[model samples]
Target chain A: MSNKTITIDDIEVPFEEGQTIMDAALAAEIYIPHLCHKPGLSPHGSCKLCTVDVDGRAVSACTLPAAEGQRIDNNTPALNEVRKTITQMLFIEGNHLCPSCEKSGDCTLQAMAYHLGMLDGHFPQFYPQRELDASHPTLVLDRDRCILCELCVRASREYDGKDVFAISGRNTNRQLIVNSATGRLADSDIETDDMAAHICPVGAILIKDHGYEIPIGRRTFDLHSVAESDLGEIKLSNVRHHDE
Target chain B: MSKLRVGTTSLAGCFGCHMSFLDMDERIVGLLEHIEFTRSPINDIKHCEPCDIGLIEGGLCNADNVHVLQEFRENCKILIAVGACAINGGVPAMRNHFTLKQCLEEAFIDGIGVDNPHIPNDVEIPLLLSKVHPIHEVVKVDYYLPGCPPPADAFVKILTDLLEGREPSLPNEMLHYD
Candidate 1:
């Protein structure tokens, strides 16, 4: 590992030669808010929540490989406001029913909103008539909750090697797709054990017959804020631990 | 000095937000000394009288909700959207994706466990709007206390601030969404 250091929010975090700013910051136990970028997955930089100021230029930390003596501003009031706008956009673009959503406290998106002081969905909701695909016996695919982070698509292709999911459409209409000819999760080779099924940061891909098992107050975010929780373990863990 | 008059009501909500206000517990008892209920569910008042503050819970899903919200906006000097529902339509707005007709059909006819399912055709029931709307959409909302139902402390904080003639602001811990 090359011992190159970059300053993020005035804190010096050392990075390997190939490490991105996000990777470096995360390695140093410094949290940068993100939804799309996950460890062990190639940084897609789709969410853009990890946008950081490198000197005067704004760049996605997940994709921006750290160079020696780089000055990166990961936390700023202006950047946080921009992030809050993006979070509001995400909420308005889809039908986000946090109260009724099974993801609720466990959802990374919800946690990010809480972290950023996004007190409300300030934008007018599009409330698109997204499809809910329950064709899969063990999982429910509710498109209303999909943020189109494409984590499942990446996880399925990268980790499980099944290529079971992909994202189609563009702009506000972009959506998750099943690999099967029928365009249903039931026909796809995505088992509940697959990384694709577990990597969903939202309520879009939920396991059937396993909701509300953990009550509201005692769920993941209830115990520990998302910033403090081990995000890698939360996203990647196949086992259901109460601490998760 | 006269006690501050406060009015409150639930529009298209599940009353969870009101429950949070009630969760203030002993704080409400303390608040009663400085505030008086002019028009509120707690006092069983129908028409909202002029008040210093109006704490509105829920979204505008139907005509009745809109009417009540408009009345609150007009009658109160400051109107506060007191939960996720009032602030941004919350759970009720989830039905915005579907037509109002479709929603009614599903609820009254198409949904499972239906025996004598006929759409209710009573004049007593107010009509649902084409889409659910947040309180701000219907009328200007002065403040928003966000949460599925903001924690009991959130109610206390806002009430305390307002009662003390200060701008209501949520502390980091009280600004929860779910």
Candidate 2:
């Protein structure tokens, strides 16, 4: 580890140098609210939900590279206000449908709402009409409930190289698309093992084979908030566990 | 002119795959050394012409989206489905449970519709694509990559191998998504 330390809000933090801000924060036991942010996945600031005050400007901790002497304050009042705005934007942008959402207690947005104390949307709702494609043997789409976080799309495009998923339209009207023009999930080239389905934070998309099968408590949504869960114990164990 | 011109296009995907290409960092300049990027986000070309490789990101969900896919097929000698969305219908395939009418009505004309107009029964408006599909279904794809977009290293390995006209030796059985 390089002898370099970065400061976040008067707190001097040390990292291995080149470690992402989110990674460093998580290592130092600081919580950064995120949905698409995963250890195995590349950090893209698409969600805009992880924005924290760094030198008085809102920057995503996941993407913003770490530098020396950078002051970070993720728990400030100003940070909460920013988070609230982002949560409201996500809430009104799509039909979140929290009451019926499978990812209720364990969702990134729900936890962010709790963290920022956001109750309702301040912006007017833009209920874009999307479809529910469940023809695939594995995944299902509840487009109405999508938050346009682009996690799935990124997982497919950047991580998978299939780019089998995409965001159609512009701005608030954007929506998820599968394959090329075929539009049928069965017809698309997506495989059962693709990480795209696992990346969706909301019910807008789900792995059909796994739904209603985990009995209630075993699903990730039922477990805990991403912030509380941290780096993800399951992934760690699966990686270099003694059993392996 | 180089025999292997290339065009990279994004359909309904997040731009992450393209970013991943950039994630290759300075290695890209070496890639740029050989092939040509005809139509890309970096380039402003709208329609794609014939090329050596068509690197497609995102899946298809709309009528116009299909047209673009067809264009890439017409233009590229070797078309590749570059992400999960193009591989197994990805996450967007989840929405096929509902009909096109329902999706459109819910998005625009339904009681919940917002700024979009309810173009009810207009011939001018393009009809919805039948279903969300993986790239191979709509058109024959020469190769399929099955990551969300696939790790950047995976991409680098595949592209370098492809450029050499040899089978890419990146993922083995364990790496296959299954």
Candidate 3:
């Protein structure tokens, strides 16, 4: 853990040689909002979740590993405002029907909203037309609920050893296709044996017979809060598979 | 339970669930007490015929997979989609980016394809589904056990519950819906 020490919000902290700025902040029990990134993952630097100001420069913390004696300030009012706006944009970007979303209590995006005190999604919802593929006996992909976090996509490519999935298209019109052309995962060449599908963090991908498997009384979401999940030992990088 | 005939298949997958099943370890000998496996690695590679429970892993890809899934559907009393691939088209479904014709051209006929192509006797590759589909798309799934190969405990839970004729209990931490 020997490296440069720096002050964030007037608190003195020591940085490990290769640890990222965000990791250090988190280690000190500080919270920063982010998406498109998870622990145990090759830092995407995609979602600006761990963004913080390093000597007045806004930067992503996950990709930028730690160095010596650098001053960082994450508690700026202006930065907090920007983070809220980013959260709003994400909410409206997808058809995140929070009231009905399966991840309503457990979703990271949802948790961010609460941490930031966002009462509404704040932007016009973009209702993308999507189909429901119940063709697969057990799993169903409801494209309408997808946020395009690309977690499942990465899980497939990296750990599954089955390169059965990928993201297609560029920006707004981007969609997830299964085997070849359609949204019907029934046709996807992906084998049922792979573990990628379970990595999806949203309802875009769901397993049958599992929903409502445990009643509301025994659920993980109501039992924990986003802030609580980020602190102490339970705070984890990848919430999908392996436990840390 | 009359010695139940069980069959397990892997289409295109990492073979984790199979390993997980094997991870049932010594308890597997206990499972062997109840099940008479027909087609599996522990046995010999045989296409699934009529069986009590047909546990399928991976999604349908290539020509052989479709036929085998169909065979299992027709013969098996209960068809279970096991693991991520079997449930949600998992990861391999990413290829829907290109047209099949384009994909074939790139993989086979085009220069990106194998240089000295070993032209095969079998021209019938299971028609690539227009896109990836979960197993239930082709046939009815009596039960679906999803996990990334599902956790080993998940397998034991689902299996033992079935054997006990009680509703299976998933791990409290395993995310079920989202």
Candidate 4:
């Protein structure tokens, strides 16, 4: 392990060479709220949720390399307020009806909103009309809840070895599209067990028959905050046991 | 101590939120000691009188809803948007995805079971807005309590805090969208 260290909110965190600031923070069991970033997948800084102040400059922590003596601010009221607004934008941009949504308790977007203490969608809701694809035998893709995180896009290409999904268009017109000739998931190369099928951070992609199986209040985020639940899992499986 | 006047009304919402407010149950008897019902379903009051606090459930879907919400805003010193509908338009706002004409046609003309297939056009009926909107869009809301129907404890917390002259804030556990 490289001896290089950086200060996150004045706490010394060591990093290995080539490790991004996010990698270092996660390894140190520090939770930096993120949506588009998943470890082991090439970082796509689309969600902008993992933005941290690096040496007084705002940068995506997942892509920014950890340099020695770098002063980073991860958890601050000002930064959290910005993150809250970003989460709100994500909410308003989509028709995320959490009460009716199957992914309400398990959704990272909702968990992030809870973590940020977001009371309401602070801005005017765009309420853009989007489509829902139920053509797949075991999976459903509801674009109404998509936040353009690209996790499914990356997971399909890198992990599942099937580039079944890709984003099309640009700006407000941008949308998730299937790679199949019919422009449907059923016609695509994706399978029920594919990483891309299960990689959506929000309710955008969901399993067909397995929704609302776990009762409310017993689901993932209900048991613990996203920070505690995700970081604890990471600590248990990867960081502490592997380090030991 | 003079009892604080409280008003409540439900617009384009399922009365679930109002039911939850009543779910305060016996504690409501204790609440009555501090607050008096001014214009609420509990008292079967129609027009709102001047009140210390107004708890509004549901979103603005029609002209009547807008008028009632504006009256609440005008009469109440503090207006709290309660539950999912009042905060972010909730299930009622689902209609926002389609045009008002489409919704009316679907409900009246184009529906599978329709004995009388015509849009209801009556002088008594309030005109539907083009889009359903959260209460905050039509009027300034002092506080927002979010949930499908925020738990009874949440209502207690907000009311107790306001009654004590404190800023209304739900605990992390009490703060949920669904």
Candidate order, lDDT descending? 4, 1, 2, 3
Model 2: docking quality category? incorrect
Stretches > 4 Å off in candidate 3 = A179-183, A189-195, A216-218, A231-244, B1-178
Cα lDDT of model 4 by residue, B53-142, tens digit: 999999888999999999999999999999888888889888888999899999999999898799999999999989888888878889
Question: Which lDDT tens digits does candidate 1 get at residues A1-244?
Answer: 5567899889988888788888888888888889898888889998889988998998999998899999988779999999999998888777677777888878888888888877767777677877889999889999988999988998898889989988889887789889999999999899987878877888998988777888887877777776887444534444353224
Decide which is better by DockQ, 1 or 3.
1
DockQ for all models? 0.68, 0.01, 0.01, 0.74
Which pairs clash inside model 1?
Answer: none
Off by over 4 Å in 4: A233-244
Least well predicted 10-residue stretch by lDDT in candidate 2 chain A: A235-244
Chain B TM-score (each prediction, in order): 0.97, 0.82, 0.82, 0.98
Using Cα atoms with residue i matched to residue i, what is each candidate's TM-score against the true structure? 0.93, 0.53, 0.52, 0.95
Give the higher-TM-score candidate: 3 or 4: 4
Grade the docking of candidate 1: medium
Kindly list the per-residue Cα lDDT of model 2 for residues B38-134, writing each as its tens digit: 8888787887877888988877877876888899999898887776566545456545656777776777776553765665667776566756655
User: What is the lDDT, from 0 to 100, of the residue B35 in candidate 1?
Assistant: 93
> Comparing to the true complex, what docking class would candidate 3 get?
incorrect
Clashes of 2: 69
Per-residue alpha-carbon lDDT of candidate 3 for residues A1-244, written as tens digits (9 for 90 to 100): 5647767777777778777876777777766566666565566676575678887788887777766666777767777778888876776566564434555555667666556644333344454555567888777787766777776677677766655556678888776767556656776755544556666655677766666655543444447655666554323333443211
Q: What is the lDDT, from 0 to 100, of the residue A95 in candidate 1?
A: 68
Off by over 4 Å in 2: A214-223, A233-244, B1-178
lDDT over C-alpha atoms for residue A7 of model 3 = 72
| Per-chain TM-score (chain B), model 4 | 0.98
